[model samples]
Target chain A: MTGSKTTEYVTLVSNDGYEFKLLRSAACLAGTIKKALDPTSGFIETTQNRVDLPTINGVVLEKVCEYLYYNQKHAESRDVSDMDIPPELCLELLIAADYLDV
Target chain B: MSGRRPRGAGIRGPHSALTDFLAANNISAQEIRDSYQQRVRQAEQEAAQTDDNGEGPSNGGAEVEEDLQAESSTMAAERTRKRKRDQDEAIAKIKKGKAAKKVQKKKQKKNSSDDDSDFEDVMDMYKKAKPLPGQLENCELCNKRFTVTPYSKAGPEGGLLCTPCGKEMVKDTKAEAKANKPVVRRGRRKMESNRLDGMTDCGPKTLQQLCIEKLAQHSEDIDELGEMPEGIMNRISEIFSKKRAMNSTTMKLFLQPDMDRVAIHEAAYLETEDYDQIFAICPNVKRLSLRNCCQFKDSNIDYMNEKARALEEIQLLGANLVSNDKWAELFIARGKDLKAFKVEWLDAAFDDEAVEALTTFCPNLERLKLERCKQIGPDSIDAIARLQHLKHLTLRFHDPITREKLTHLIRSIGTNLETLCLEHFLDNTSDPTDDVLATIHTTCTRLSKFRFTENNECTDAGYVNLFSHWSNPPLRYIDINSTRDLDNTNPDGPQESPIGLASAGFLALMTHSGPSLEFLDISSCRHISHETFTLVFDGVKQYPHLVEINLSFCPVVDTHVVAGIFRSCPLVKKVVTFGCFRVEDVRVPQGIVLIGAPRAQDLIEQFGEGSLDL
Candidate 1:
């Protein structure tokens, strides 16, 4: 829980066993992931420094990760450009966005 | 009957203000013109005599020309010096309005001696001594001799400049002007909304608001807002509709095949076919609410009648394009299923017959609202009276109806009503003993929100009777603005019993309903004296539920009354005191807002919620 143990990055594992090692700040952009990995809450994921999201598949999770990084990059800005989204995976990505609360 | 022009008849257009001022001082316009003409003729005669006696002395015309040339040469040198000094003064004047006033006074003194100088300047303007085309002329800026051309531009001081130098000067002036201009950036609408919310901060939006705005910015890029809670979906829909992103493509994502209700808050962008699409998608929907549906047509309703048979409630606003016959047909077809029906801003078609048809068909209807619909009149008053199940009734009409018909309408349906809002019965003959208010007091027992506004007809006694020992539970909202005597001659109305909601009635209203009242607007109830205001909001008696109160145009309300309101109404969030100029020096608490006081701007603490920095 102290500052000494805090890592620069955290791991996110998808339902299909794909792991993404993302910057801690970027990963915390998603509200659900932030709450899960919050140090004060003492969640299991907080100690482990990894979140396993079983409901979201790797394809959707990868898009969410890309969006999290994109959001962090343009957090304190105006007139931000939209991230590219594929037409076919829109519904699935929306489900992932809802789960992540982004 | 003297043959003179009538007063005010001659005023057809704007007359010269200077001419008026001269006429007021007894200096005639005719005399001024005649004297000017005589002076010109005398000067011409003297010049003619000089020409005739040319042999006696030197040539008069040549000598006069020589003297003028010598004066102009001296004037040119003086002008250059004056121009530099004037430019410096102009720059200083631009920085302060006070400096400009001093400069203008100095200019007036100079203008009196330069009367003929102005005339000479005008003459020189028409007869420029600049070199003609094909003649060699010195470039004013570079001091280089060049052939004069028609395309040459005049330099700032006077003489013509070479083409390149002129272009460079023009560019330099434009760039300088652009650089000196102050850039203004404003989020004016955001500021207005924040003011309405009693927020003084000019800071950035909250994180949630920002995220919603960003999501709504690119809503088209989103395919589905996929499976969030109902409240979140509606909130997203609200943001989307406000941003006007609820067109055909985005609308489809909002409606699911299984959802029972489809409420689109802003349907201004939807096409006529989209109305049919509501049924096409959500066929089993029970309640349908579409506002600003300007394109709603008869065929859409027909499609809905066939598809959406289980439709129990419908609210459509600004759907004026639908014919009267379509309204009758819809009521006939699905009237039995309807429990609540609200239609507003329908000026073109929906008439008294529509009400007749609704009452005849819809026996189960409980909530009815018809606001700002033009065509319905006294004819439908009795027809609406037939509905036994009406509870929440709001009728803000723009038409003619005698007190008799209105009294009948209220008496028949008032027993079951919960919220009654009646507006603009202004034309009704004054009732010193208001039969309508009497009926409301006796019959409507369940009312929580009551509004009777813009009436010069009801006497104060009527309101007094209604609230004094009334059977109805305490009302939560009361808005009775513009309910006073409107005689222009008497600023103070009849003093014996007072008129409209005066002291007795207002006190009675507070006594009965102050406990449960959450919102109150007694604006423009001018007859209620300052003593009554202070007595009612006396700081010791607490009205626990009151949140917002408007005392606008109530001129007698002072700082003491405002402070007492803060003490008495602990939950009060906003207190509007516009035109209550006497309300200064009150210290508002941290979360409370005190708005519209003329001199309360600087007095607001930094932590105070209502600080409006002027």
Candidate 2:
């Protein structure tokens, strides 16, 4: 956080108090985060530089964070057939995506 | 990079991120799995223990064990019988449920009929007590809560709706009502081929048909063909012509000796003698329009000239048998009294000499239209320009004339011209210049209608200049379709690159004279962009009088611009979009006629067969 060489990151806390530090660009992929962190909106999340998702648990939040990073990496690439999602977390991941409007 | 785990590693190894995350959070997946398995095994063991207790009594004492076993066996049999009775009762319950559903449906039907009668009674009450503003109600369509305002309108089914849903309901009901209208059949009469001789072999003839046949059979009893309405007379003549029943005797029904106006649309079967008989009967005919009069020969024309001397207007189409000299003689005989004369599709007759004779003899001619006349040249136009009383002139030339001759004609007939329509169908290289437009703008101050189609030489500068400061009264109709500027020098460029009227000229026309325009056709003027279209028709300046518009072949017009036109022009009743391929999803207002929009079939189909004239 001190030097320009270090990457800037934002902490997203889940309902069970699990914190996942993600890059700002990847976190902005979620529509909820984009609206909360909008500069003109003057939201508490924008001033505090942290967001708390009360509805999502730690396990589902972890999967959502990983998907956001994966989507950011393959945003423009057309060939993304190698990206795999576990069958067990499919239902939970869908619920989280709907909550975040991702 | 260090914080990021490799892809698919979270599902594989002991040190997977998911496992680490679960471990750090004090929640283990193995614990949950083992607990679930243990719960399932406990439930299974409890079920097995119950089965063993039911089957075995050896753990009790020997004497009591035998008696207990007997009692248990009898009790088990009784329980089995009870289970069978419960199964039967459940089946009866299901059948009863189905019958109850049928009874409920019958009751609902009765209630609906009662509601219909109640609704009629409520209509009188609703008329007395209309809903007031500021009342909260649930929208009938979406069930959303809304407060009724003064602007809220009632839905079609007597339900209340929010503002947005109310508008949609109105649109849907209008579309449904329009789609339900019975279509009127037109074109090419439907003749009954089987009942030609009024002898129906299978069924009895209709009362009307029987009456008509009896009247025709007893022709001697009918002494006079009594006075009938003109429309019915036309229908009777058309029926007679279609049935091949119009012989010399039936023709006498139409040819009354005292008739002043007569029009025969289908006279192809009328021979030369029949036409001579028409002239012999109707001597004082003032207005006569004959279509498909192929048997009208020189002798018939001579007879018409001698008998119908009071004729003021005559319209003849497909009268090609009358020779050019005979037409000239006819004009020379009665052209002075003729105020309006129209002839079309004369293949070999009515040439430049006849035009000279028309201009020379018909000094009081006010309306003259000669369409598809190939032999008329620049000299004929020069002769036509000399008529002082010519108010309406329409010339569709099959041969090209020089631009100088057109300019000379416009300049000569400047002040008195009210309606001028000039269409060129030849592949002529000569284009009308800006000077000709300027001459028209300055001279034709009284012009109310002007149509100049297929002149691919007029430029944007000329149109812009003509509309910039118009001194004439607002034109009621203006059609300049296909008047593009095709740059011959750079033919390989884009097709719409050099258009005659661009966005600037169109904007100028709208700002200056759009208020009074009732009919405007700018089809194939491809240089106007959607931005300019939206800007001009953005509900800022309303075109209250515009009724019909044709925007065909304009590539830039899309659905948004069409919606803007609907918003601005309140009186627009007819919109023709033939080749505007981008314009889809149009919302046609109620009572407005839309034509040739292929992609807007959802909206257009609401208007039944008679609504489209394509």
- Which numbered prediction scores highest in DockQ against the true structure? 1
User: Across residues B1-614, which tens digit of lDDT does each residue of candidate 2 receive?
Assistant: 12224467766455878878865654546545644565556556655775778854345334544564566556545655675567555765565456555655665666776757556544544442333456555677788878778877676566677999988878888999979988645322222222122222222222223324444444334444566545545555665665566666777787777888777766777778888888788998888877778888899899898888999999988888888899889889886898999988888778899999999998999998988876777788899889889999998987777777778888888789999898863335554467667878888888889887777666677788788887878789988887775566763224443446778778877876787899888898877778889898786678989988889988888777776777778887667777888888665554555566767755543222222211
Least lDDT summed over 10 consecutive residues: which range in candidate 2 chain B? Answer: B187-196
Estimate, for each residue in B57-99, the C-alpha lDDT of model 1 and write its tens digit: 3476556655655665565446546755675556544543443
Point to the candidate with the largest lDDT. Answer: 1
Clashes of 1: 0
Could you tell me which residue pairs clash in candidate 2? Answer: none
- DockQ of prediction 1: 0.04
How far off is each candidate at the interface, as Cα RMSD in Å? 6.6, 37.1
* Top candidate when judged by TM-score against the true structure: 1
The lDDT for every candidate, in the order shown, is 0.79, 0.71
